[model samples]
Target: MDGEIRTRFKTICVYCGSNSGNRAVFSDAALDLGRELVKRRIDLVYGGGSVGLMGLISQTVHAGGCDVLGIIPSALMPIEQISGETIGEVKKVSDMHERKAEMARRSDAFIALPGGYGTMEELLEMITWSQLGIHDKPVGLLNVDGYYNPLLALFDKGVEEGFIKTSAREIVISAAKANELLEKMELYTPRHDQVASRTSWELSQLGYSKPPI
Candidate 1:
């Protein structure tokens, strides 16, 4: 166990869309999450981009005097423009795979806001890694504006279809608002058996040899 639940995590990884959604509310939610992170003195770990919701969240956190660490691929550096120099360190990596790996290594928890395919990719990778016992960090979804309701339902469907175990689904805490989700994260304790069991079962079902961890 990670011991006592700290009021503020040292760093939290946020996965959000590179493009802000059509609704102003989505932007508002992003801003709110940023402010909340700042108020708690939690550092932000994310894709180093200065566009759309990604920029909004990072900038807002910076404005609130919170630390922001960005890990961006070298290719996107020219496009993302890297935000505030005063907030925290920004490390440019060779590619997207490296970017995601570094961000995961740096964060204590993971939160996914409304995003597109890229965001989904990041979140799923985190989940898979957690399932593999690569890390025991907490993972959550900020279901702002009911944005993730359908996806949540789909996860439930996965459980029903036996493609995903109920225990694996339980690893992800979700809330319609940021504060609630953060609270749940503070209380999180990863279930190692659940993670191991699912990984072993999935590997066997796929007829693939499970790699020794």
Candidate 2:
């Protein structure tokens, strides 16, 4: 850990499956991401859970001396919790909307690990928020083992079909490995034009004190 490089992000929100995928690579990638965060002295904000990739990454980051925060919807608490051993600081929100909002407000950036509908939903919202100028934070995808290849391609297709603006395609920073993804995200700059002024968006309603300047 000598001469460790400092990261621009103080905390990053990670969206991953509550169920670890069939392959070991997914779990490995999640743990690797956690270690990278610790190395960079960055903390973690994630969906609250005590199983699967969520548990793996959270425990790894917490054990590495970095703060870990888990935000979960009240309805999911019973499903995601394990033996009454949720890690770090757990915040229970009233619903999914509040859960996602809290996660965004607490983190400086985001990373999406290979997951199912819920994970993709969270990732897409962050990207949409960036598109609308709600926040300029980097949104990264840990495309482990090419799991996200199709989704990435679909995004490209959107750009090609005119459904998505060309500039907005750069909103999702992606890489196959945790180290590479973090490196890419650290250098990410908001190149896309915002749909509206951030001030006009009334960000305080989402728990943000102020939008990124």
Candidate 3:
């Protein structure tokens, strides 16, 4: 057994909005992501709540008989908690920072669905972590309806400005479909170890993250 090699991804972390955006495509993408996880037998780790995209995905995955974990800060419960039944296990932490740490700790890969500020912050933080070598797990954007095009442009601009390295920009992988994204992420090899680290100033303000939902 000691010589046995395990599958690289058993559980995936998803960062999404507390509120579902005003687009049917967004909800459809979240549902597709959940269904894909179930089909792959991959569990879920995400912000705890039953409202918005979080609820839609978790519930979809749970209904498909997949294990789902929801982690949320105690204080944010009033705003993020689901009204009816919640799928799988739900963990409540003391604060937002703990919530994020718990989510990151339990996941093997990360995907971002179309969302608002909370989703952006969570997704960006994960990319930053990968950039800093805190973890080399794959981070992906669902990019539904090209919602993340602007964000991608921003990263490119950072590269153009000479602040972000060309290599660092590769930290984020994306796909329009859930299965394709997962497949790409599965093939992802950490290139960080192959290259020198960027300056601390370039990754300044990098530390523990707190999601604002």
Which residue pairs in model 2 clash with each other?
A: none
**Where does the lowest 10-residue lDDT sum fall in candidate 2?**
204-213
Model 1: per-residue Cα lDDT over 1-213, one tens digit each: 222235758889999988889999999989989988877888899887778898899999888777888887888887777444533567988888777777876788999999999998889888887777666688999998888899899999999999888888888889988889999999888764534543444333222355322
Clashing pairs in 1: none
* Residue pair clashes in candidate 3: none
- Name the candidate, 1 or 2, with the larger lDDT value: 2
Cα error, residue 75 of model 3, in Å, equals: 0.5
Model 3, span 1-213: residue lDDT tens:
222223468899999987888878989999989888877878999998888899999989898777999988878878888467767898888887777767877788899998888888989988887887666789999989889999999999999999788888888999899988888998998775423343423322323343211
Q: Put down candidate 2 lDDT per residue, 1-213, tens digits, no spaces.
A: 774678888999999999999999999999999989999989999998989999999999999989999998899888998986668999989999888888988899999999999999999999999999998999999999999999999999999999998899999999999999999998999999899978889788678676665
- CA deviation > 4 Å runs, candidate 1: 1-8, 82-88, 192-213
TM-score of each: 0.85, 0.97, 0.86
**Displacement of the residue 25 alpha carbon in candidate 3, Å:** 0.5
Candidates sorted by TM-score, descending order? Answer: 2, 3, 1
User: Could you give me the TM-score of model 3 versus the true structure?
Assistant: 0.86
lDDT of 3 at 41: 77
Q: What is each predicted model's overall lDDT from 0 to 1?
A: 0.81, 0.92, 0.82
Give the winner by lDDT. 2
**By lDDT, is 2 or 3 better?**
2
Q: What's the lDDT of the predicted structure labeled candidate 3?
A: 0.82
